[model samples]
Target chain A: MSVMASTPSAPVKPKSNTRLRNTLTFWAFVGPLALGLLVFVYIPIVWGFIISFFEARQTVTPSQFVGLTNYVDMLTDPNFVKALVTFLIFAVFIVPTTFFLSLALALLVNNTTKGTSFFRTVFFLPTACSYVVASMTWRMSIFNGLPFGFANIVLGWLGVAPIQWINKPDPPYFWIVLVTVRLWLQLGFYMILFLAGLQEIDRALYEAALVDGAKRGWQTFRHITFPLLRNTSVSILLLSLIAAFQAFDEFYNVLSTGVGSSSNITLARPPLVYIYQVAMADQNYGRGAAGAFILVAIIIAVTIVQGRLFGLGRAEA
Target chain B: MTVNTQTDTGRRVIDRSERIAIVLNYALLIFLSIIFLIPFYVILRNAFLPSKLITAFDWTWLPMPPSTNGWRDLLANTNANIVDGLRNSLVIAILQTVGQIAICSFAGYGLARIPFKYSNIVFYAILVTLMIPGAVTFVPLFVLVASFGWISTFQGLIIPGLFSGFNTFLFRNFFLNFPKELEEAGLMDGLDHFGVFFRLVLPNSMSVMMSLGVITFIGAWNSFLWPLVIGQRSETWTVQIVLSTFMTAQTVNLPAIFMGAAVSILPLVIVFLFMQRYIVEGVKMSGIKG
Candidate 1:
C-alpha cells in the first residue's frame, strides 16, 4: 500500500513522471485489444460504409465504383421490404411478451422464500445453454411437428387437435412457436437482471410503505419496487431488442430446410438468412455485404432511438 | 373495544395471507421447475434412442428402455477423432480465457487505479464495440484471415476472439473495487507496475478472475459463427459446429447425435456443476446485469 498522501494535495494529482509511465504501460496493455478493435471491429464497420460505396464483390480487391447503387437497390428491393415487414412482425410479437414473462418469472422467484436460490439457478441455467442446442431441441423433440411430439402430446391431454407449430396459418403458428421457444430460453436471463435490480432496492423502503397506510401486496410493488427497477428493465429490453435483430441461429439451424421437406412452414427470408443465402449459398457477396450494412444501420438506429427513449447511460454513473 | 376487534381481525387476515403465500409459492416453484426439467429429459431420452424411435415423435417421460449402445458406438470412435472438436474448443477457450484475463487485468487495473489521460476515451471506445455485431466486421476479417493464411489454423480460431472488450470492462470494474493501499505498498517497496500487477494484483483478483475465466471458457466453448467460418479444417472444428451438423442429418441416427452432443456438453456441465457460484458471478458480469 503506497498511497500515504491523505493530507497532501486534495485532488492527489498523479505525478507527471508516473502519468507518463502509466500512459505507456496502459497502452501496452491495451495494444492488442485496440489493434483487434481497429482491425476486426471499427475499421470493418467504417469499411462496411466504404464497401457500400464500391461494388466490392469479394475479399476487398479489384472492385468497381458503384456509388449509391447498393443502397438504392436495397431501398427499391421488394424482398428486402418484405423481410423487413416480417421482421417487424416477429419483433412486435416477441419482445414485449418476452420481457413481461420475464418480469413475472422474476417476481415469482423473488417472492418465494423457500428454494429462492435453487429456483433462481434453475431458471437462469437454460439461458447459459447454447442457442443452437435449444433451437435444435425445439425443432426435433418438443415442437417436432409430428403426432406424438411434445406439443402434440400436451395437446392430446387437453383434447385439442394437433397442429403444425411453425406452419399453421390462422393461429399464426410459426410466430407463436418461434416466440415461445425464444422466450423460454430468454426469460431466465432477464429474470436475473430483474433480480439484480430487485436486490439493489432499499428494503427499508418496502418496510416504510408497509408501516404507512400502503397495502402490502400491489402497493409495495407499485409505489416502491417497480420504479427502482426501471433502469435494469430498460437495459434488459434494449439488449433483447439488439439480440432479436440478429436472430440468425434459430433461423439458420432450427428452421433450416437441411435435408428436410421445404414445403412445410417456410419463413424463407429473415434478413440475416437472406444475406447468408446470398453469400454462402449463392456466392452473391455484393448483396450479402449490402444486406449486412443495412442491418448494421437498422440496429444502430433502433438502439439510438431506444437509448433516447429510455435514457440508457453509455455506462452507469 | 371496536378498535381492538378490528386489530384482531387484521391480524387474522395477515395470518391467512401468509399461509396462502406459502402455498402459492411452492405451486409456482413446481411449475417453473417442470419448465426447466422437461426439455433436459427430452434431449436426454431422445439422444439415447434409435432414429426410428426418436423421429417417431414419441414424448415419453423416458426412453422405454435406455440403451448405452449409442454411447458405446460414439465412444467407440477411438481413432474416429471424435475428440478433435472438443480439443479445438478447449484449446481456444482456455487460451482466450487466459489471454483475456491476463491482458484485461493489466489494462483494467491501469484504467481503474492509474490516472492516465485518454483512459476514458479508450474505455468508451471499447464499450462502443460491444454494441457492434460480428457480422459488421465479417467481411474485413475474412480478408485479414486470408491474408494471414490462417484459413484453417489454430491461429484463426484463437486470434479473432483474443481481445475482448467485455472482459476488459469486467476486469476494470473488478479492479476499481480493489484496495489501492495494497498496490501503493507494492509500489512503495519499489516494485514496478508489471511486478506489482502480476505479483500482487492478480492473486487478490483470483476469485474474480476465475469467474471471468469460466465465463470466457463457456463463451468460447459455445462459439458458432466464428468457429464455422474460421475452422474450415475438420480437425479444427469446435464442438458446437460438430453438434450442429447433426441438425442437418438426414439418414443419421438420433441417438448418435445426442450422444455426441451429450459428450460435447459433458465438460461444460462438469465445470458448471463444480463452480456454479462463479458461473453465477460470471453471468452477472458477462450477462444478466450488463
Candidate 2:
C-alpha cells in the first residue's frame, strides 16, 4: 500500500526511452476532463467568489467592487435570514428522521427470511424516480389543497374537515408534504447503504457472539452489528446532512410558483430556492453569489464539526 | 442423551422466534409497501381518470372505469410538449452519460495506471473540488456558458454536466483495484495504453460502467433546476422542466399534470423494474466507498 501510494510520484528507474511518450499519453487521457473541471467548475467557483465581492448582476462583469458589502447586505436581508432558518429547521427535522427510518428499514429487510431483494427493490424504486416526478405527483395530486386530496380524503373518513395541505400556514402542514416526499425519494437509498454495511459484517462475529451467550438479537446487534457499522453510519449521516443543506428540488417544485416567480415562498423555502430567486428572479447576482458562499461556509463548518466528532478518518482499533 | 435433548430445545426455541420474526417482517413490509405504493397509485389512477373524476371528493384507491381523458388533455396541452421534451431529455441524458463515462474513465485510467509525475497532485486537486458545494458554482457557470452563447442550447445543458468529480473518483477507485495482470498481458502483446484500455479494461468494466451509466442517465433525465434554468425555451425543454411547468403553472390542471408526471416516470419505472439489481449495486457502491 505504501509503495502504491508513492508510485505515481516516484520516477520510473529503467524506462528512460519512452518518458516523453508516457507523459504525452498521460496528458491525452486526463487533459479533457481536467480542462472541463477547470473551466466549468474551478473557474466558475473563483469567478463566483470574486463577483460576490462586487455589485454584479445581469452581466458577466462586476460593475463595482464593494468588498464584503454583498455579504453584509445578504446577512442583514430578512428573506435570506428566513431562508437559512427554514433550512436549519428542515435539516433538523429531516436528517435524524431519515437516518432512523432508513436504519430501521435496513434492519428489517436484512432480517427477513425470504424475498429480501424484492423488498429492497420495492423500497429502492423511488430512488430511481426523480425528485421532479415525485414532487409533481405530491404537489398536484396527493397534497393539493382540495377537499378531495389524498390526505384530505383520509381525513374526511375520520369525520374531519379538509385542510389545505399545500397552502396551509399556521400549523405548516407543508412541512409534512415536503418531509414525506423527500423521505420517499431518499430513504431506500440510505437503507441500501445500511444494508450494504450490514452485509459486510462477518457472519462469524455473530456466531461467536451467540456462542458467548449473547442470545438476544438486540444484544448481538448492539455489540456486533452496530459497532461494525460505524463507518457506514457516519458517512450516511454526513451524506444526509450535505443533502439536506442542498435541498431544493422537492421544496421548490412543491412550494413555489413556477420559475421567475417566488410568490408562495414561505416557511419551507430552502437556501437554494432563495438564492435562485435572488440571483435569477431579482437578478441580484452579487448577493446571490455571496449567499451561495455563505451557505457553503455553513456546510463546510458543519462537516468539519461532524468529522471531528466522528474521528472520521481514524482507523478502527 | 442429555446433549441431544438440549440441542432439540434450542432448535425449537430458535424456530419459534424465527417463525414469529418472519411473520412480523412480512406484515411490516406489506404495510409499508402499501404506503410506499400509494403515491404511485395516485399518479397512475389519476393519469387515466377524467379531470372531474380525479379532482372529485370521492375517494377510490384505484380508478374505476379508467378514462383516457387525462392523457388526451396532456397531449393536447399547449404548455407541455411531452413528445419534444421526451426526445430532448433522451438526447441530453444519453449525451451526458456517454460523455461522463468516456471522460471520467479515461481520466481514472490515467491517474491509476499511467504513473505520471504529479499525478497524485492532480488527483488530489480533483478530489478537493468535491469540497466546494455545487451551489457555489451555480451562477458563474451559467454566466460562463451564456458568454459562450450556449444558453438554452444543448451545449449549455450537456457540456457543463459532461464530467463529474465524484464519478472520476469512482472510476479511479475502480481502476486502482482492477487486475494489473490483464494490463500487463495486453502490454506484453504489444498493446499500447489506449489499445489496452479499449480492448482489455473497458470490456472487463461492464459492471461498473453500466452502474455509472444507469445512474447518470437517471440523474440527467430527472434533473430539474439546471434544465429549468438553461432550457427556458419551450422548444428545448427537458421532460422534467415540462413536468415542473405543468404543476407550477398559475392554473394547475391536476389530471393533465398527473398524466404528464406519469408519462415522464414511465421509462424510469421500466428501467428500474428491469435493472433494479444494477441500480441497487450502483447506489451501494456509492455509499460504501464514501
Candidate 3:
C-alpha cells in the first residue's frame, strides 16, 4: 500500500489501457439502458410527433402531410375540449382533497403511539388493488344504481329515492364514484408519503413550541409542522397533478357501458380516454397523437406554474 | 396551601383533556380504518354471496349462506380463462420486475459511480423522459411493437416497461450514497468495475432492490391500459384484463367479477404482507430523497 501510494504516476501505456478499460466498463453498464430508452421511449415520441402532423389515418407511416390539421381538429373537437375541462375539474377537486386527506391521515397516524403500523398497513393495502378491480367494485356494488346497492341502501334508510349513479350523468353522481374509487386507491399511498414527511419534523421544535405556549393540536401544527412539511406538500401536489393529467383507467372502466361499447359513454372522458378512442377505436392515429402532445404541453405548463407557485426548485438551490 | 390545591386542580384538568384527545384520536383512526377496509370487505362478501342475494333489494352485511359458486364459476368459465390470465400475469410481472431492476441498477450505478465523460448528458436525457408520460408514447409504441410482430406476446408486455426513468432515478439516488470504501476495497483486490458492481454493490443493495422489486411487481401486475392494448388476444390476457372482461361481458356476471377481483388481488396482497417493512422504508426513502 505504501509503495503504491509513493508511486506518483502510472506508466503512460498502462494508464491509457486502464482509461480504455474504464470507458468500456462505463458503456457496459449504461449502454443497454440508453439504447433501450432511445428505441422504446425517444423513438416512439419522435415518431408520434411526426405522425401527429400527417393524415396518418389507419397507418402510422403516411404519405400525406396535413400540416396541423390534426391539432386543429383536436382543439376544435368538443369531446377533446370537454376532456380538458374534465381534467381541470379533476385536478381542482382531487389535488386539494387528496392533499388534506393524506396529510390528516399522516398526522393522525403519527400522533398515535400504538397500532401505528396496523393503521398504516390497513390504509395502504388498497394501493395494491388494481384500478380495474376497484372501479368494478365501486361501480357494480357500491354505486350500482340498484336498490340493493350500498349507497342506495343508505339513501333508502334516509327515506330518499335511489339514484342511478353512473347511467344518469345529469346530476353527475358518477363523479362521486370516480372520486371515491380514486381516493380509496391512492389516499393511503400518499398518506405514507406524508407520514414520512411528518416523521422528519424535529421533535425538539414541537417541544420548544409547547414551552413557548403554543397549543398542542392546531396551533403547534400550524406554526411548526405545516411549515416544515412544505417540500413534501409540493412534491405530493406535483405527483397528484401529473396523476390527474393521466387519469384514464378508472374513467374508462367505470363510465363505459362495457368493453367494445366504450364509445357509448360520452360523459367524463379524460384526454387519454378520448385520445384512445380517436386512435385505437376510430384508427385516427394522427388526431390521437396530436391530442397526446396537447395533453403533454398542458402537463408541462401546469408543472411549471405549480413549481413557481410552490417555489419548488428555489429551496434546493 | 391554596397554591398547592390550585396546582392539583390544574393537573387534573390537563389529564382529563389529554385523555379525551387520545380517545378522539383512536376513534378517528378506527373510523378511517373501517372506511378503508370497507371495499375489501364488500369484495369478499359479495364474492361469496349468490348473485340473487347480491342484487336483491335487501342488503346483507354478511354472506349468510357462503358459497363457492362464484369462485367455481370463475374457474370453470372458458372465455374468462382466469387460470391462463393468472399464469400470463405472473410471468409478465416477474420478468418485467427482474429486467427493470437489472437495467435500472446498471444505468443508475454507472451514472452515480462511474466517472464517464458523458454521464451528465445521459442522466438529463433520462430525466427528460419522465416528463413525457406513457400516454404520449403508447400509440407509436404500439406501432413499433406491431412492427416487431410482438403484439400479444410477453415481449410486448414486458420489454417496453423494462426501462423506467423513475426507477433509474431512484436507483441513482440510492447508489450515490453507497459507501465508497467498499468499492475501493473491491478494486484493490483487482476486481474489475463489473465484478465490483455484481459481487459487491448488488449484494449489499438487497433492501433497495426488494423494495423497488415489490413496487415494480405491483405496478406491472395491476397495469391495465398497456396490457389491454398489447395483449388483445385471449391467450396473452393478464389477470387485470380477465377482471375487466367480466364487467365488459354481455351478461355482466357480478358474482364472477367479484371473485376474479379477489383472486387478482391475492398475489399482491401476499407480496405486500411479506415485504411491507421494506415497502414502507422504500416510500420513506423516496419521499425524503426524491
List the lowest-lDDT window of 10 residues for candidate 3 chain B.
Answer: B281-290
Ranking under TM-score, best-scoring first? Answer: 3, 2, 1
TM-score for each candidate, following the candidate numbering: 0.90, 0.94, 0.96
Q: What is the lDDT of candidate 3?
A: 0.87
Q: Can you write out model 3's per-residue Cα lDDT over B216-282, one digit (the tens) per residue?
A: 8888999998998899889999998888878777786677779888988998899889999888876
Provide i-RMS per model in Å. 2.6, 1.5, 1.6
> Scored by CA lDDT, what does every candidate get?
0.73, 0.85, 0.87
- Better-scoring candidate (TM-score), 2 or 3: 3
Give the B-chain TM-score of model 3.
0.95
Model 1: fraction of native contacts: 0.37
Candidate 2 chain B minimal-lDDT segment of 10 residues? B132-141
Q: Is 1 or 2 the stronger prediction by DockQ? A: 2
Instruction: Show the colliding residue pairs in model 3.
Output: none
Give me candidate 2's TM-score against the actual structure.
0.94
Q: Give the DockQ (C-alpha) for candidate 2.
A: 0.70
Residue A259, candidate 2: C-alpha displacement in angstroms: 9.1
**Decreasing lDDT order of the candidates:** 3, 2, 1
